[model samples]
Target chain A: MIELNDYLILSGLLFTIGLVGVLRRKNLLMLFFATEVMLNAANIAFAATSHYYNDLSGQMFAFFIIAVAASEVAVGLGLLIVLYKRHGTLDLDNLASMKG
Target chain B: MYEQIAFYLFSVLIIGLFLVTVLTKNVLYSMTSLAAGMVLIAGIFFTLGADFLGVVQLIVYVGAIMALYAFAMMFFDVTKDVKENNTNGSLIFLLGGLTALMFVIIMSAPIMSENIQALYPPMAGVTNPQAVGMVLFTKYLVPFEVAAVMLLVAMIAGIILAGKKMDQSLTTEDDVIVEIDILEEDEK
Candidate 1:
């Protein structure tokens, strides 16, 4: 049967994939996408635990996390756009001299 | 039996998207696929019975974050991403090995013996959302407000950065002239 351990295992794999993207992709935008993968992995685990205990707290925490993630996207996208217009690209290797 | 089957199916879906998010060449496409993976995770949440989070995951993640990704992508001239697409397969294996090691380290920690670690049965009425809302609004209100405030700041910052582009680009006529001249000369 679909067990909690299975969900955790799946999330673990997904989280590792995100970590791989974050570690390997030199493109700033891809890094952002990877970060989203990681966030979703956390959400999955949160929901799973909440379901296991039949408690609302985990769900509530997930709710808050969702709200914050949305805001993070809004801001992160804006910064990315600015970087693109100014630098004409989104490679992380090229952005090291930023924030001056 | 059905639960086991569902677990395997969800696991494949999640893991497949996990790889896609890392391997796709196009950033926007990867982001969309990530959204798909998130919705599937939300389904997993539903399976777990966290209805509130499942719905919130849809509204906030797929709805909001994916849209923002699309918006950011629209601003870029993606053709300028000229580097050859390359990935280190050996590094991927290394990362995988490290993760497995870390997982083993975490899951094997000797907390109490299984007999001692087993908990009493949960209380009869502890499953509702109201109890959580009460705790959040009462005990965790401060951090909650801080998160909200952080969102507000992020929104303002995004708008400012996006808006500043017009002023800077328009005002920098001298910088554009030389670049325009070079482009025109090359076209001839």
Candidate 2:
């Protein structure tokens, strides 16, 4: 039997990978991808718990997370385009102009 | 038995693909692998009996979001390698490991305390999507409407930000400024 713990472990692993990517990757788009991975990890945990406990609330949360993610991409990608236009590079270090 | 096999297979594949998405330097490879990983996640959702969520994962993440990313990638020099300045490598690994361990411990707490009950259990004879629709319409209606409004706002903002007017920099090279310069020269 595939227990809830298995899904949770997998989710944790995925989330950790995402955190590392966020820490290490310099590209703005890649950073966004890493955040997507983290969000997906949370979704897995939520859906799994919802399944095991026979509840819909966890899935509801997952649904909201997806909607938020979509909104994030729309806004974030627009910002990225503007940034790329102003500055020719997508490197995070170069984009860190507000670091005073 | 089959479900277990499917779950394990999907887990391994999803993890590997996501690793490629995160670790790869090539933007095209990262984007493609991310899309594949998302589709595999939808498979996992199906095995977990979240039919609606599985479909949404397929459509929104794989279909819409990934496509948007790929389109955005075309705006930049995709062939150029992304340069990263990771100052402390060992620290990242140490912190990531500790975080993963802490998450594992926290997640296990739920399994240890099995008495936590479901708030809205799935009613018998109700399909997953049907049940979701019922709850969403009645209980989650306000939030759903809010999400719609948020998405609308995001769309408008994205259009405005990435619009054609971006070509004319107000501080430097604006067409209107050039026209004004031409008019001042004529007046002089």
Candidate 3:
């Protein structure tokens, strides 16, 4: 039998992978992708908990998270395009014009 | 028995595909893997009997979101490899490991408690979608409407931001080169 802990563990592992991507990647698009992975990880945890506990709240939270992620992507990708247009490169190191 | 096998299989596939999504240098490869991973995650939702959520995941994440990303990717040179400078590998490992450990401990803590009870348990005869609709309409109606408004704002913002230079072809823009040169000089 697959325990609830197993699903939680999987969620944790995926979250870690996403964190690594966020920390290590320099490409702005890849960073956004990493955030998406983290969001999905949280969704898994919430959905699994909802399933095991027979609660609708966790799934509802997951639904809201999805909605927020969609909006985030819309705004974020727009910002990315603008930034890319100005900078000509997506490298985080190169985009560091605000470094004091 | 079948659930166990399916769960294990989907778990492995989902994790592996996400790893590829995170670690791959090629954006195309990463995008493809992420989409596949998302589809499998919907499969996981289905396995958990969240039939409505599974379908939503399929339609939203795999269909709408990924398609938006693929469309946006057209503005960039997808053939070029993404270059990253990892100056401190140990710091990343240490941070990632610590966060992972913390997440695992906090998430699994509830599993040991064994006292959690469902607040809104599903009706015995109701389908997953029906139950979700009932709770959503009655309890979450306001938030759903708010989410719709937020999406509308985001759409307008995206359109305004990206529509600035819509007439200029990204690949064959002489002014873009001139602008980059000016910006580089400003930096120097």
Interface Cα RMSD for all candidates? Answer: 3.3, 1.0, 1.0
B123-165 in candidate 3: lDDT tens per residue?
8899999999999998889999999999999999999988896
Q: Which portions of model 2 miss their true places by more than 4 Å?
A: B104-111, B164-188
Ten-residue segment with the worst summed lDDT in candidate 2 chain A?
A: A88-97
> Least lDDT summed over 10 consecutive residues: which range in candidate 1 chain B?
B111-120
Over the stretch B6-113, how does candidate 2's per-residue lDDT look in tens digits? 999999999999999888989889999999999999999999999999999999999999988988888798897777777998898789878878887886686687
Ranked by TM-score from best down, the candidates are 3, 2, 1
What lDDT does candidate 3 reach at residue B152? 98
The better candidate by DockQ, 2 or 3, is: 2
lDDT per residue for candidate 1 within A1-100, as digits (tens), equals 5656666667677777887777778788888888888777777766675565554555556767777777777777888887887888777767778666
Q: Model 3 residue A57 lDDT?
A: 84
C-alpha TM-score for every candidate: 0.78, 0.89, 0.90
Regions of candidate 3 where Cα sits further than 4 Å from its true position: B107-115, B167-188
lDDT of 2 at B61: 95
Better of 1 and 3 by DockQ: 3
lDDT of 2 at B187: 100
